[model samples]
Target: MAAFRSVLNVANSAKLALSSRTMASHPLAGLLGRLNHVAIATPDLEKSANFYKSLGAKVSEAVPQKEHGVYTVFVELPNSKIELLHPFGEKSPIQAFLNKNKDGGMHHICIEVRCIDEAVKAVRDKKIRTLGEKPKIGAHGKPVMFLHPKDCGGVLIELEQE
Candidate 1:
């Protein structure tokens, strides 16, 4: 009787573990925050900025990151800024994604978070594939990491914490 009880206990524990795993893997589960910005790839940063400004985005100061070979412009909307990314190099990741997608439209959506490490851990624990394992510096000098589109439907999701 004692051995049977032990076996039943182990089985129950295994079932609980599996249930947690299922919840973690759910598409909508483990979402810690909301969208911060929507990034759009443009061949000309200034042109895109002007376009957005005309739409009442209140564009901010233009900043250039030579290391990543990108010229970033921000348009501050009521809630969030629409990030305009201009690729200065052929190897820019945004350029690659744009080329592959071949759609002149919304690129990636940024999500704001308080704890980047915790956010990344949650993503990993859920077995969601992420691009950068560790947080890296991003546009506007913010700490950010990208979750591959494969894990977030067909839209690239960037997690940002400043």
Candidate 2:
């Protein structure tokens, strides 16, 4: 339909505009060639941490993520982290995700780039659909944005930086 096509054009144009602006402010532009971390969503944080510990990961202490309404535990590997999220409040993003997925599982894959804004632009140029209109302040004061799985070959990708 002509209307649908018009809507698509507008959305595409917006993506281009955003990508250009992001590139201008990119800090991680030098590091888009590697991955950073992976996030898993679980209803029970302790159980998840125990499971990863069995796999020989040195997990960090459970960190309270009050802003995101979740308790977070981190498994530090040589290259990446496996972050386990336990929902703490009804408004938690984990709670919303679990309600939709109906099970504990992989939530999002995060790539730690030197410049998050540049990575965002790269993904957008590849025609990936991003979730956040702009990078939001995440736990531990990190800036993060998520890319829609449908545009990422069925994988939810998160872009993050300090």
Candidate 3:
């Protein structure tokens, strides 16, 4: 009877350990915040900016982000914003995207996070791959990281620190 009780106790302890590990790996609530912006890859920056302006949206002037190899313009909306991306340099990251999508289209979506480091860890724990090992300064001058599109239902996801 004593030996049987010891075995039962060991099984119960193992089950509790497994459950604790599962809980620890689960994503924390409120890790992700509001949608920051939706990025669009455009061949003609001015035309795209004009289109938004024509729609009575407040559009920002093109700002060159040489480090990121793209020029960006923000179209302000009540809820969120639209980021228009144009290739800046020869090795612009969005060049291939523009080539494939000549008319311009939705590129990526940026979502705000309270803590970027914590968000990255949470995604990585769930086997999601980040585009870069560390977060980089994004167009909004905030720390941002892009998650692998393949893991995110065929859509590129950008997590920006808010």
Candidate 4:
């Protein structure tokens, strides 16, 4: 229909505009690529994974990162992946997060970037606080860093190197 076509045109135009626009004040603007994954912290990773399985999702095995102190699992989907996270060691980085959110909920969202080092420096220069000393190799085997939730509108953001 003509009406539907017009609406689609407007939507496509909006997407193109957003994709090309860049911010001079914030260096990260126009740099972040796709939404790599959405992460959820779970008290019981097995139970959560099983719940997704009930919905007919293919879930990955629990992968533990000793340095990061979290066990991770990926719920593979047709278009994207959902990462299920759980605290592992005594000094898990997720402890404080779980302490505040007892039921464990959406933890962070990861966006891809071409170069994480450059991205880190740019955001750091803008006074954004990062979780650790430097980017660590994440579950995807890519260098990733976490931006403080306070600086990121109360939602933790992970920037992964593409």
lDDT of each: 0.79, 0.80, 0.94, 0.90
Model 1, residue pairs in steric clash: none
Residues 27-143, model 2: lDDT tens digits: 435555456678889977788899889999998888888877888888889987788887877788889888877668898887766667877787788677788777877764788
Model 3: which ten-residue window has the lowest total lDDT? 23-32
Give lDDT tens digits, candidate 4, residues 1-162. 999999999999988777666443346676788899999998889999999999999999999988789999999999889999999899996777799899899989999988999888888998999988889999999999999999999999999999
The model with the greater lDDT, 2 or 4, is: 4
Q: Model 4 scores what on Cα lDDT? A: 0.90
Q: What is the model-wide C-alpha lDDT for candidate 2?
A: 0.80
Tell me the TM-score of each prediction against the true structure.
0.74, 0.69, 0.83, 0.82
- Model 1, 1-162: lDDT tens digits are 999999999999999999999988876465657678898887667777888778876887678777666677888877777888777676776677567656446788998887788888888887888896698888857788889888788888888884
In model 3, the runs with Cα more than 4 Å from the true position are 1-28
Q: Which candidate ranks first by TM-score, i.e. highest?
A: 3
Model 3, residue 152: C-alpha shift (Å): 0.2
Please list the residue runs of candidate 1 whose C-alpha ends up more than 4 Å from where it truly belongs after superposition. 1-31, 101-103
Instruction: List runs of model 2 lying over 4 Å from the truth.
Output: 1-31, 100-102
Alpha-carbon shift of residue 38 in model 1 (angstroms): 0.4
Q: What pairs collide in candidate 4? A: none
